[model samples]
Target: MIPIAKPYLTAEDAQAAYDTILTGWITQGPRVQEFEEKFAAYTGAKYAVAVSNCTTALHLSMIVAGIGEGDEVICPSMSYIATANSIKYVGATPVFAEVNQEYNLDPTDVEKRINSNTKAILLVHQIGMPADIDAIKKICSRYNLKLIEDAACAVGSAYKGQKIGSHSELVCFSFHPRKIISTGDGGMITTSRKDYYDRLRLLRQHGMSINDRVRHNSKKVIFEDHIEVGYNYRMTDIQASVGIKQLEKLDWIVTERRKIANKYHEALKNIEGIRLPLERERYFSNYQSYSIYLEKSFPINRNRFMQELLDNEIATRRGIMNSHRETAYKHLEDKVNLPVSEKLQDRSVLLPLYVPMIEEDVKFIIDTILKLTQLKTV
Candidate 1:
């Protein structure tokens, strides 16, 4: 069956990994530092810290931002659990906020949820499409709230000509196999604040005053003390080797994904009872996952449509989970009604999308969807 997502790796990545292994500096070393520097340059951020995964990156961001017990982090209900899990990791409450049709946090709803307990707004660029960050940033600025961008799906995405990671005080990225870029399993945090950058660097490596890489290169064999409690979330040099190669091809990979998205948009635009993904003006999406919403009038329910696609050798996925409904967060009082988020959860489905997928594959998926829609009308 066709997979919902796939990672594109070439010999370049393999060679880089081999070189790192031969050097015997596999743990967080020169390669990791190089990856961080390259990633920061690509996103135009002053600093980037590589970690084990996006979850850890988010957790580090929270710790650096001083979000802790009793502090409420406003986040969209419709997002991957990692976004909410990070808040819990820091002993903070994640307050649910409504989403717009774009499946992004509604700035208006976010503003209403802001209270004295609220410390930050954690916004996800869902499915590679950018959130209404300009408006969200305004809300954060007005209330002096810290803005954390869970940009796991938006590696090459941009808003108003600025990269996604550049806008927020702290932005988290993922390089999972299914993501636009892959380093096996890794994450990075980008920020302009020097203190936050330093804090993240320290927090990712067990709060060590000096990292092992620095000590290894030093003539002295003396070790350092732990400054604060931190986790062992450092990314290995081997993984960073792969990441450096992936970074080189990021733009080309994003271009291919966009081409596939455009093909879907062109083919599905005329189909009735289907809402295609939207590309807001001045925004550029990586199209990491091509998601479409089945309209209420569509004769076939989302589950049935997904099943049919799967039966026809096409794979699909439900949209990101509603964090408020998860067992972890159910106990918290959900004061806000996220109608849009709930509706999206029911109707949204992700289509097969990745680099190297031929044009014919896109057409085939579109045709299958259109045929299914037509059959339901009979």
Candidate 2:
């Protein structure tokens, strides 16, 4: 069966891992530092901290931003549960907000949620589609709130002419296998501020005054100090090595994905009850996920529609989650009105999208969907 998403790994990626493993400095070391520097350079950020995954990146970002108990972090209800969970990790409450048609936070809704307890606007660039950064930034400025970008699926995406990481004070990216690039299960946080950068670096390494890299490079046996409580969220050198190679091919992968996305867009545009994902003005998405919203006008319900796709040997998945509806977050349920987010949670589906897919595969997926949707009209 055609699967939903897969990594574009190659012999080079495996070789990178092998070579790094052979070096015996397999934990967070030179390769991690090198990967951090290279990623920062690529994304136009002053600093990048390589971590275990984006969830930890978000958690650390919240801690450094001084979000603590009684603090309310305004975030969209429509996102991976990790986004909300990260806030909860820092003892802060996640205030669910409305999302726009693009499945991003509505800036006006964000404005309404702001009060003295509000600490930051944790905006997500959902499914690689760039949110209205300018509008969100203005709101953050007006309310004196910190703006943190959850760029987990937005590595190659851009806002206006600038890349997503470069525009935000704190931006978290995932290197999951499902993302545009994969480092197995890793993440990176980018920031222009040296203070935030240093804190992230220290926190990822057990709040040490001196890190392993510095200790290894030092000519003398220098002891380290535990400055504060910190988590062991460091990314391994083996993963970082793979990430470096993956980063080299990132642009090519994105270009290929976009080519396939365009074909899907053209093939599916005229179908009834199908609402395609949007690339808003001045935004450049890498199309990490090619998701579509099936309106209630459709003859088949979401479950049956997915079953049909599965029977056709095509894999599919539900769209971005409504974290508030989760059993773990029962307290947050029905606490806010997020119409667009709720509608999407029930109706949207994610098609297979990855670097390995070519034009023919995309065409096949599109054609199959067309035939299914056309059956009712017949």
Candidate 3:
């Protein structure tokens, strides 16, 4: 079956990992530092911190931003659970906000959720689509709230000509296999503030006064001190080695994925019962996951549609999740009402999208989807 997504790794990626292993410094070391520097330069950020994964990146972002228990962070519930989970990690309340047609936090609804307890706004660039950062920034400025970005799926996405990671003060990115880039499994946090960069480096490695690399290179004995409570969230040099190669291929990956997505757009635009993902002016999406929404009056429901694709040797996944509906956040069901988000979650389906896709497979997937929708041709 054609899979929904796959990492575009080459023999060179494996070689990078192999080379790092032979260096005898597999943990966060020179490679990690090099990866961080390259990533920061690529995204136009002053500093970048590598972590275990995007979740930990978000956790660190919250800590450095001074979010704590009793504080509330406004965020959209129509996102991966990790988006809200990160807020919970710091004992802060996650105030669910509504999403607009673009499946991003609606600035109007976000403004409504603001209260005295609200400390920050965690904006997500869902599925590689850039959110309205400028609009949200205005809200933050007016209310003295911090803005943190969950750019897990937006590594190659741009907004108003600027990369996602460079726009926000604290932006978290994922290098999961399913994301645009893969570091096996790793994350990054980019920031312009020196204070945040210094503290994040310390906090990611148990808050030790000196990092392992520094101590290892020292000629004299060095005793480290734990300055504060911190978590073991460092990325290994092995992963960083792979990430360096992945970073080099990111632009090409995005270009290839967009080519596939455009094919889908051209073929499926005429289908009356489905809606395609949006790419508004000035917002450049990497099309991380090509999701199409089935209208309420569509011939088949979301589950059946996905099942049909699977039966035809084309794999598909349900749309973005609604964190508010999950058992972990069930109590939020009564507290929040997100009509747009709920409808989006229930009606949308993620189609297969990846780099290095075979032309025939892409055609087959498109033909099968068209047949299932009873269009046969577009």
Candidate 4:
């Protein structure tokens, strides 16, 4: 069966891991620091803190951004629960906003949701396509809201020539296998703010003023005191070793994904009752997942279409896991009308997309989709 996503790893990654094991410094050591520096340089961010996963990164960002009890963080409803979960982790409330037809946060809707209790705007670049960053940034600036970018699927994506990590004050990236790059399971937080960078460094390692690596090299064994409560969210050196190698090939992997996306666009553009993913002229997406919207006129419901694909040995998924519908978040204020987001929740499907997929696989998927369309017409 063709899988929805797969990690691309080479001998370089294996060799790096071997080296880390041989060195016996596998817990948040030199390799982790190296990975953070390289990632920051790649995204043009002043600092990058490697963590256990994107969820922890988002949680750290909330703490550093000063979000706390009763504070509302405005975020899109059509995103992974991690975006809202992080806000809750900080004892803050998540105010869900609507999304546009493109499955991104609607800036206008976000503005209407902002209240005196609002502290931040958490924006996710769903499926690697950038959200309307420029408009979102403008709105955040107007309201003096802290902007945190949940760019888990947008590692190499850009908006208006600036990288996604550079656009927001705090940006989170995932290195999960499903993402453009992988370190098995890891995440990083990029920021231009020096204070945030320093605070995050402390936060990731149990709020200790000094990290273990620093103490290891010192003549005196120094035990540190925790300045504030923090979690053990540091990425292991083994993971960082793989990440460093993956970072070297990030651009190539994104290029391959984009090639597959282009093929899908050309083949599926004319098919009625199908809405192809759109990339604005000013943006360059990593194409983490190639999502297509099934129009209301489509004869088959999204669930049936997904089941058909599964039967054909092809794997597909619904768009970003909707936060509001999830059992954990159902208690939050549900009065907001997120028409576009809700429609996408019911109709959108993510086709198989990854760096290793070739043109042949792309053709097969597109042909299968077209055949389904033809059958519906009959």
TM values, all candidates: 0.97, 0.98, 0.98, 0.97
lDDT score, residue 161, model 2?
86
Q: Residues 1-378, candidate 2, lDDT per residue (tens digit)?
A: 889989999999999999999999999999998999999998988889999999999999998888999999999989999999999998999999999888999988889989999999999999999999999999989989999999999998888888879998799999999899999999999999999999999999899999887888899989999999989999999999999999999889989989888888998898888999999788999998988998877767777788899998999998788998888887767576787898998999999988778667777888888778766621
> Mind giving the per-residue lDDT tens digits that candidate 3 earns over 283-362?
99999999899996677888889888899889998889999999999987998899999999999999999989999999
- Ten consecutive residues with minimal summed lDDT in candidate 3? 369-378
- State how far residue 370 of model 2 sits from its true place (Å): 1.2
Better of 2 and 3 by lDDT: 3
Which window of 10 residues has the lowest lDDT sum in candidate 2?
369-378
**Residue-wise lDDT of candidate 4 within 1-378, one digit each (tens)?**
889999999998999999999998999989999999999999999899999999999999999999999999999889888888899998998999998877789888899998999999999899999999889889988999999999999999999898778877899999999999999999999998999999999989988988889899999878888999888999999999999999999999998999888888888898878998888899889999999998878878888889888888899999677788888977753666777888898899999998788767778887788778855632
Separate clash counts for every candidate: 0, 0, 0, 0
Model with the higher lDDT, candidate 3 or 4: 3
Off by over 4 Å in 1: 332-336
- What does each candidate score in C-alpha RMSD? 1.3, 1.3, 1.8, 1.4
Model 1 alpha-carbon miss at residue 147, Å: 0.8
Worst 10 residues of 4 by lDDT: 369-378
Query: Pairs clashing in candidate 2?
Result: none
Candidate 1 residue-wise lDDT, 1-378, digit = tens = 778999999999999999999999999999999999999999999999999999999999999998999999999879988999999998998888888888888888899998999999999999999998889889988999999999999999999998888987899999999899999999999999999999899989889998887888799787899999889999999999999999999999999999899888888887777898888899899999998998878879899999999999999999778977888777653565777888898898999998799767777888898889766533
